[model samples]
Target: MPLFKRRDGGSIRDRFEFRDVLGTGAFSKVFLAECKAEPGHLVAVKCIDKKALKGKEESLENEIKVLRKLRHQNIVQLYDTYDEKGYVYLVMELVTGGELFDRIVAKGSYTEKDASHLIRQVLHAVSFMHDNGVVHRDLKPENLLYFNHEEDSKIMISDFGLSKTEDSGVMATACGTPGYVAPEVLQQKPYGKAVDIWSIGVIAYILLCGYPPFYDENDANLFAQIIKGEYEFDAPYWNEISDSAKDFISHLMCCDPDQRFTCEQALAHPWISGNTAYTKDIHGSVASHLKKSLAKRNWKKAYNAAAAIRQLQLLRISSSRAVTGNSSSNGTPPNRPFPV
Candidate 1:
């Protein structure tokens, strides 16, 4: 039973049956859809107007090509694409939960443990992208999505409209979410993948404090604050978080791009060390770590709690399938309602 229903019998290229709208942005609109050939399978169809792709068609094509070649658990998966009559549509995985921004807004702020877990997953996804020669110029909460419900969601980095594939070279595009953009990017300097690390640091700050480290009513003042690297933490929030977590963030947020920690190094930090109860492996691997961390305070406790909830949810979804389903024993379906 899909949550959204198809619209007006409209179909993309006579293949994907358009369900309800998922979301809309400046250049495109996303819809939850089903492939006519594959009835129960669900996907996200991004419909970009031909007018919007006029000057940037090549960039959009490049993003599709790059995403097609990339396959990782942490990164959003692209299934298919087509350009019909006048519209360009990209079919991708339907991460059911929602945007990461919603969760941060709801919680006001996250604990240090939660922040570390989320950052680790983002790092892993970015690291995989960099390894494939793709640089995600846009790294922000809005671009990151949860695959399931908020408490036990898998974070998947999405929206590659501004992404580019760089073969060991620097990119000059001054593009990224405003508050999360790095100083070098703001200065229009040729930058490398390190810019992603800077954005990660900003995300880390927001996750722990409910707002960015540098914010101002005026855009100029905001840029100045970021350029100067001026930031601080209030007592209670700062105290509950571990010193190692703070050190790790400071390292990632280094003003000098050359000095900032890489994704690999960040994963090795002590703040993220320990076994995750929700995952099979110890320390939970970067992606699973973020999901499990958000579900519980301690890794072990959270893992166990998530597992229990998943079992219950599965039983509710289908008792017969709950006994035979091959989906991960750890995750719960996001579309299913859960008690707060």
Candidate 2:
């Protein structure tokens, strides 16, 4: 009963006036809502259809549990949750600035320094999550959002659907976007918080170069590349990026999780903490690659890909088959179109 109650002791439906639809998923729809008690006070209300979440309830519940415990400036805040007869409602902080990469592509003068600053904030939030025993299994650019449209708007990490707690114990589940997943994950090896750090490394790589480090038309080949930790900074792209920046990525993207840089270590690296990050404008190259590589990928395509991956996982689980780096050779792109 308390979950549905607002500060004014009214039910959630009566407390907030729901507005335009913000997002839609297989089983849920997020709406922009304004608190009636404080006019103009806004929030994102995710309305989930229980009937549609028959087999997927656990994922939603897990996300709620993880979000409820996380309190950080860079992480999206989950304000409250409620369950009604046919639907469950999640009231959350409304971030209006849009996706992280969109902001970067739109900027007139993006540089390594700017990329470093953005990654620093992400590292801070992820470091907090690690300290709290939470692993955001999914840390792609799509998951990174901006708090507002201001030039100095802070980055906010959103979408905890794939997040897991350390308490869950030995995490061997093959999850996360194909391009950003860690080597250990692709190999189906037991992984920990290092996966998130690896993802950050991949994100850092893309930030400097505008395209993914590991890419292949085949999912099996892509997995193989990641499993081997084979990726290059490349010319034209890396020609302008400083060595310190590349070093920072190498540390985080190490194949050995034990050797991979922790969030703290990454945060302290010269690229992130010092002045080694180049101030030169690489916006032309970066933006060009971003548009050429990621422009065609819309939210719907990403959502569908994620759904297909989930279904594939379910089938794999049912068959009691282990998915090794080489197992998925069907040539089918699991989370293709790359970085969702």
Candidate 3:
């Protein structure tokens, strides 16, 4: 019996009105929903299967515990949690704009200036999470959400399913997105918050070039490429980017986790530090310029623009299907590293 079902064996829909399925993952499903008591207040409801969390009771508790203590502009806000018949549900804020990956796929690539603006926001958010003693572990594009449709949109790091609080100086969980995982993590070595910075480097690389730095068809080969630091930038994609931007990524992608820059230090790098125009007023502040701009636009227009971009990308993908089929084509996949 699911925790969310009624004693009479009714479904969750019998109570709350589930609007649309936002997404589905291995462990749970996310829905845009509204409660019977509050029809106008929209919310994102994540439903985790009781069976999926069966033996991981401690993990679930820890997730809630860490989320409760987090209060950062970049981190998603958890509004409430409820356990019904057999399902566990988490109510969260629903950002109007979609995943950052969607926007990045639409534009193919971003200018160094724009990339820097986005990375700064990510760095501030990660810094705040580190200060609060939480390590996100998973910081991929899929987990990043934009508040609205804007050039400098507010980015919120969501999906804390792999996050954990560390007190012993380092954590040894072999968790995180494959290409973005730090070398230490791939090697099963103990690591700290610096792992997040390493992932950020991968993200920055993708933002500038429109593809992940280390990629291979085979998982083992992919991990090897990442560990060996095998990467290159095509002239077409990187010709206009600054040397400072490249240097910053190189420093963060260092194989030795100990040598990688901390979130604070990374923020001070020339690429991020020099771009003061994009930095928020305080640490961890989302880019207000983009957020405000998005707020002023008609949402319907913004939606149409976003939809058009997606269609364009799909058409390109369809036309180049044969070329993309080659394992080494190195073509940037649509929004795989979604940039907002």
Candidate 4:
């Protein structure tokens, strides 16, 4: 049989020389490796212990099945697979550009145009996958990788460990990161490609504003926020963002999947189509917001009652902004976090 069909003739240790471990999880460890036969050829080797996979074989099989059939510039390439007595190894492309926000935070100057280009590639890859009947189910910052350390390096969507390939066009699996999970996923309803759209909306929102749409220290509160499909683009954060960009996110984060935008439709959106005209200097505000948000989350325990009152003041300002505009809330409930 061809190598693609099976690499069972010899041990994977004979093929690639393993280097430092890149990452680790409950059942698998990803390591940086070099092809022994082709010196300097680096790859990521994800090794999963069979014993650890006893109950999760379905996920692994689903990942492999989907990856084997996918070939795109934005999606990470799966080079080969090998199985040993106790473990299954996946050989994949090695990416070094780092996660989505890391790169954005690294660049001294970034903008809506740059974010648009990045998301365009992701949408294209997603369009291809949906066209082929595969759903990535899990789309988050950690899963998006860059090909190299260069500022212009390409983004590759990695980590299909939770991906599923189904012909039914709808699935009932409740798996994904808590922060970026779609409303339908939390509701345990049968869903489809629209879930990926929701994830992309969250990503795009962060890209433009440097903060997650829904956030709460309490997981239950966070889930409640997501299930309501309500989030705000407050002033100072969203004031600099373009209306077209906001419109794009509005279409994706809809609570009803049937009403959400599809990949093809998103690609043709005005913000994506006219990216060249977007603001080119949005890094300062976003970076500041990220720093502030991180500091606030980390030092919450140190804040006194005065700080709590200050938070209430911020919400009041947000409310006043709502009232001054003489416009209704963006479907926000009376009890929701005052738009801040």
Score every model by TM-score.
0.73, 0.88, 0.73, 0.83
lDDT tens digits, residues 272-338, model 2? 9899998999999888878766655752234322443465455553112323444333223344223
lDDT of 1 by residue, 45-92 (tens): 888888877887777877887889789888889877766656778889
Which ten-residue region of model 4 has the weakest summed lDDT? 319-328
| lDDT score of residue 274 within candidate 2 | 93
Question: Which model scores highest in lDDT?
Answer: 2
Instruction: Give each model's clash number.
Output: 3, 0, 14, 0
lDDT of 2: 0.82
Off by over 4 Å in 4: 1-8, 168-170, 275-277, 292-340
lDDT score for residue 46 of model 4: 92
Model 4 Cα lDDT, one tens digit per residue, 1-340: 2123453577789989999999998789999999999999999999889898988776677788899989998999999988677888999998888877767777899889888988899999999999988888889876888889986899999888777777744687677776677877766678888989999999898888777787655344555567776588877678778888989999988989999999999999988877543766999877766655544544333332234334535555332232233222333334322211
Clash count, predicted structure 3: 14
Provide C-alpha RMSD values for all models, in order: 17.3, 4.6, 11.1, 8.3
- Please rank every candidate by lDDT, starting with the best: 2, 4, 3, 1
